[model samples]
Target: MTAALTVSIVVPILNEADNLPKLFEHLHQLTAKPQQIIIVDGGSIDGSFTLAQSLMTEMITIQQSAIDWQVLASSAGRALQMNRGAALASGDVLLFLHADTKLPNQAMTEIALAITQAKWGRFDVHLDSNKLLLKLVGSMINLRSRLSGIATGDQAIFVRRRIFEQLGGYPNQALMEDVEISKRLKAIGKPACLTSKVITSARRWQQHGTWHTILLMWRLRFDYWRGVSPDSLKRHYYNT
Candidate 1:
């Protein structure tokens, strides 16, 4: 029998203290004690840093070096932070997840099983909302992954460590890194859709309204494919 595969789950966050504990608790309950968890932060002023410090067992901080806040306006993007987490990862498989998302109980097992079969993938997501528009957005996103091999970070991305590094990690742009990386991964190996699902918060849809949020995300994707600057994309990103 081959050795057990270890998955280093990389989660990138900013001021997400309110969501960290629940996320950790859910993750711990889901995956078996397989490998490690690396939480990369973008210099959050909120309690997120302290919360990470508290979960010092599997959870650890990366790049504790201080950062200039204004750099976010320029380079402190999610892609940069996620790459930092990837650098610190030591698992055979790297699973990139969002801090607010919770994977199903079968996550780690399914990942291990899939990777064992020489497959690589991530958990599909079920948006947490009852509204029809939100459900529609969720369906569209999942369908896009199945049809085009592009998945958002919220769905969770798992890849072999060497394969990820060989691809030179996620792009440094503020947006579209997930799409870009998955495109490359698809060319090298098609990513599987795990039977288990992640319950990602639909707060963005709640805040922006389902139709409006979906339209904006699709437009951003189109613009990115057309080579729009991330700065320009984020300038109009819904932060409220």
Candidate 2:
């Protein structure tokens, strides 16, 4: 019999203690468990790493679950943290996830199936907000990613381990590393474009104002595509 493919869910986080508990709850309930859950901490002062480790210990004590979780420290950058996590992963596939995003119950199963057909892909996303504009934004993001072969980090990008290594993982960028990687991957093949949505926190949009965030994102993308350096864009992103 053929061995089943194993997946490593790699999450890069910084100061996300508030989101870790809910993230772990969804992860532990996954129907198709990953071979390992690698959390790469980017110098969080908020005890996020301790919280993650404690949760794993709790899972083992309470349910006797074999929780294969690794918490590693790295430089404070999402791309750097993820690359570190990917290096330590021992699975056939790598799933890059955001700390504040919650996967659907069937996400692991869907990802396992999708990876068989395509080397890389991302799930659709639903923002956690009742605002109609947020709903529309989510729909547009899904549709745009499907049609343009590009994906945002909130969508939960996954890739074959070998392919990821060949692509050199995410670029060393201060921002828009997701977009940069998507462009490179699309050159090789179209993504699986899974329709099932992963629910992500709408806090960014909510905090910045929906319309304003939307316009800002578009401008960032345009600037990135027009040859603006990620460092310059990163400064602009945080300054605004």
Candidate 3:
């Protein structure tokens, strides 16, 4: 009999204290929890690291759910933190989750089934907003991902640990690590493209006008495809 695959969720956080509590709460409510959850702090100044440590300790000493929870510190970069967490993970599959994203019900079960057929995959994602334009944006993102086999960090991207390691993990870049990794993974096999949707925060669009942010992202993506350096793009993304 084949043994069931275990999953390790790696979350890279940066000054996300405001979201940690809800994120942990959502994890606790999962129908099929992951084998372990690794929270890698990326030089947070807002006590995010302390909060994550406290939450992890409380979950271990109180909830005692059969899930292994860990808190780690890493350099201040998503790709760096994620790669560090992946190095410490001990599961057949590794799922990278954003701090502000909540996985859908049975997400672990869905990934388990998807991994059997594909080396990696990602869940569809929707923004947590009632605006019709934002709703349309989510639909367009999902459709584009399915057609291009490319994924963004907002979508919960899961992959077999072996393949992830073999590919040298996420590229050590300032931006577009998710896109780069997806391209490499797609070369080997098409992603499962699960329809289960993860709900991601729409704060970016809310803070910056929806159409403005959308156009900026599109321009950045086009520039990236045109061989513009990620470091340059990162500066532009943050400055704009």
Candidate 4:
């Protein structure tokens, strides 16, 4: 087997204590180990920080083959937290992961090979919901991403460290930073558009009705593309 590439997985999290165990479990089971994993905690009120620390401690003591890891506390905001984590990353590639997402099998090796072809890329997404509507939503999400060369954070966006730096990192927006960054990356080169999928929580869609959430997302994207301010779109998104 080929050696694992040097990948720094950076996760921006908030109040994800319930999800950390599963997330870390998958991280520990990677066929190709990451160079390091950085958890950027966005001031979670839940015990997420403690849980992550405990998990890291346990991995250090029990695992013979373990990736280096660290937990950083940052102000609340996904874009801010992710940019901060990337600044501290040391690997050749920086992967921005959402806390509620799980990478598919061999995702690490896939990313390593992917960055060789493109400056950045994202895996397709699978929503962890059995609802037929959500399954279709997942398919559309992947198809839209593939057609547009844009990626979302839930898709586990990865990029060469130097290219990420060249783009000045993700735009410091209240929301839609991923879309903005993807646009900039696409200007330089098309994304790899890997076939592997990352399973992400469908909590938002479940909290709202599936169709309602889908419409809201479509509206948000249209507004964003039409030059709407992210701050305004963020208010509309969470309020809906």
Best by the lDDT measure = 3
Q: Give the number of the best model, judged by TM-score.
A: 3
Clashing residue pairs found in predicted model 4: none
What would the per-residue lDDT of candidate 4 be over residues 109-154, giving only the tens digit for each residue? 8887888788889999999999898999999999999999999999
Q: Poorest 10 consecutive residues of model 2 by lDDT?
A: 59-68
Q: Write the per-residue lDDT of candidate 2 for residues 1-240, one digit (tens) a residue.
A: 014888899999999999999888888888767778899999999999889888878766765656578889999999999999999999898999999998878877888888888989999999999999999999999999988999999999999999999999999999999999999999989999999999999998999899999999999999998999999999999998
lDDT of 1 by residue, 58-138 (tens): 333321321111111113568888788778777888888898888767676777788865446866678998877777777
Compute each candidate's TM-score over C-alphas.
0.87, 0.96, 0.98, 0.96
Q: Deviation in angstroms for 12 in model 2?
A: 0.7
lDDT of 1: 0.74
Pairs of colliding residues, candidate 2: none
Q: Supply the global lDDT for candidate 3.
A: 0.94
Better of 1 and 4 by TM-score: 4
What is the number of backbone collisions in each predicted candidate, taken in the order shown? Answer: 0, 0, 0, 0
Kindly report which residue stretches of model 4 are placed more than 4 angstroms away from their true locations once superposed: 1-4
Q: Which 10-residue span in candidate 3 carries the lowest summed lDDT? A: 1-10
Report how far off residue 71 is in candidate 2 (Å): 0.7
Off by over 4 Å in 1: 1-3, 57-75, 117-119
